[model samples]
Target: MKFAVDPWDPTYGTSLGTELGESAAQVALDVELPSSEWQPIDPDPWVVPPDAVLFVDGVRRVDAQVWVDDGGAEAAPALCASYAAGVVCCCKDGAHLLTADVRRGLFTTADAADDVRTTAGTYRATRTAPHPDVAPAQLLSLALQRELADTELAAAAAARGGHDSVHGGADDLLVIDGPLRGRQHLPRAIGFVKSHRSDYLPPQLGGVVAALRTGQRTPVFRLGSSWERHTWYLRLPCRPGAPWAGVVRVECSADLSAGEAVGHAARSQATLPRFASTEYKDSRAPQNLYPIAGLERELRRRLGEPNLLYRALRRAAAA
Candidate 1:
């Protein structure tokens, strides 16, 4: 039997089916699925002058059971366990782990020193309401996740500085797994978007996205919304499935000149394809680069043994 996963949608009883049908129809009419018509880019030394490429991503998980006063029935006290980690690597050399930040026992509600760890990490207390409707436990979990992301970015930046000091200001490129909104000033840094949640391009430009081939990339263009950045699409090498299967969007700092942006595009086209993961190596395959995959595993490991942390939290909360 094929297992299917469904999102927690309140509209499932109402507009979910209608929304899906409309979305499918819109994709058929407006968007063209990716094809193998992209411009092939040769690996050029001038394009990728960086000594290393740093891949940065964050992970967070909440253990509501950590302090389940009433067996996690309703409005129970909870804690968010979060951590951030970074990895830096080059094509020739493997990955080097960076210092990670871990925060545990972040309280879900406003309480005065409810637990030992919570009291130690005094900033873990949630004062303001995140949302009027969301449950307290969920809100605290969301807040912890946001905090984790910020910490990851900071760790990534610190790692870059640390690497520079060791390697004598080597020109290293940083590839963050999400949008580079707050990190606009990071030199030689680019955001790597894996999923296609929204159509950033117009109908005319949809063909350009569709034409991307393995190890090929689209032309650089300005992506403007709340934040602006020079972005391009690159299809990583992978076992063929669908047109857009291995496509990843790369975006660089908008503060750069046009030439610099184009340079970043070229660097991404050359560098990213080298790190593309195969189906055998990763479940996510090409979009989840090798360094990134390893980095994620390392981060989770650094987050401490899950069972141990949970038990400790439970015991501390009971005290």
Candidate 2:
């Protein structure tokens, strides 16, 4: 099944040639200027900045409008099915630090004894109850994970398809908010803890991964905002030994470099066939996306990739 993998917060609010404030921004996908819409392929031997890992596209300017079509005849549904999932692997606990510290340990006070413990630098109160540092960090760790129950792999393995659908029309597509562990993200983040730490994947991923591999299906990873606000950067798949594999950067938050994005797309398009032939296949490299069509047009104008406009025109013709 043809799959399109996109991260939840791939757009960068910061600016061009600049990075985000979070340390995770270190892993952002670099953008470049867009290519000419008149030509299909970008200029050969395209020049790139020496430090640029991911280049921007050619079209640095953009304008787009949604074209609504209401046909009388029955339109064909997606040839296959679609599904979506969002996973919150980590949580943010900075807000509740003070309230947690003020009520540390058992004192049998009038109010519910403050069982919450917070970490150092978690808040700005500059006051603490002389508790251990581990307590606060542990407390702060529950922000993203607050919703996920069945914490043990053995307790129940995972919660069944609780809330996996979010896409507009996804009958044949099954999308996950995080990696399926069939890829490289987890192994790198938590390390291979024996058989890689999948205890955090919440079981749904386990069943999905089993389906993808057994059916020779391609699964899409849609890294979400829960991870975005903290993690900042995400991964993309590259050809094994392709020099850029395991490459990651902050999501889409940098200035546009002249042809980097398109070059990378071209590279991906050309590399797909060869990459498809390899056993070490993956689709989790870095990604650049804009939630707002205007932002996408501006960025695409800068980088020169106008797949949006072309797709629109094609639809217009079929109409």
Q: Which numbered prediction scores highest in TM-score against the true structure?
A: 1
Which structure among the candidates has the greatest lDDT?
1
Model 1, 1-319: lDDT tens per residue? 6542222122323111222221121221111124233344444556645678888887766644443343334544556555665655663466676556665545555433343463223225443354679986677667676676678778877888888888888778898877776777888899987766666555565666556677677766676666677877788886654546677878887788777887888888778888887766666776778878787787777666666666666565676
lDDT of 2 by residue, 224-312 (tens): 33243111111233233322122222211112222432433333322222111112221222222211122223333332224643453
| 317: Cα error in model 2, Å | 60
Ten consecutive residues with minimal summed lDDT in candidate 2?
95-104
Q: Given candidate 1, what's the lDDT at residue 89?
A: 64
lDDT for position 268 in model 1: 84
Indicate the TM-score of model 1. 0.78
How many clashes would you count in candidate 2? 68
| Candidate 2 accuracy as lDDT | 0.21
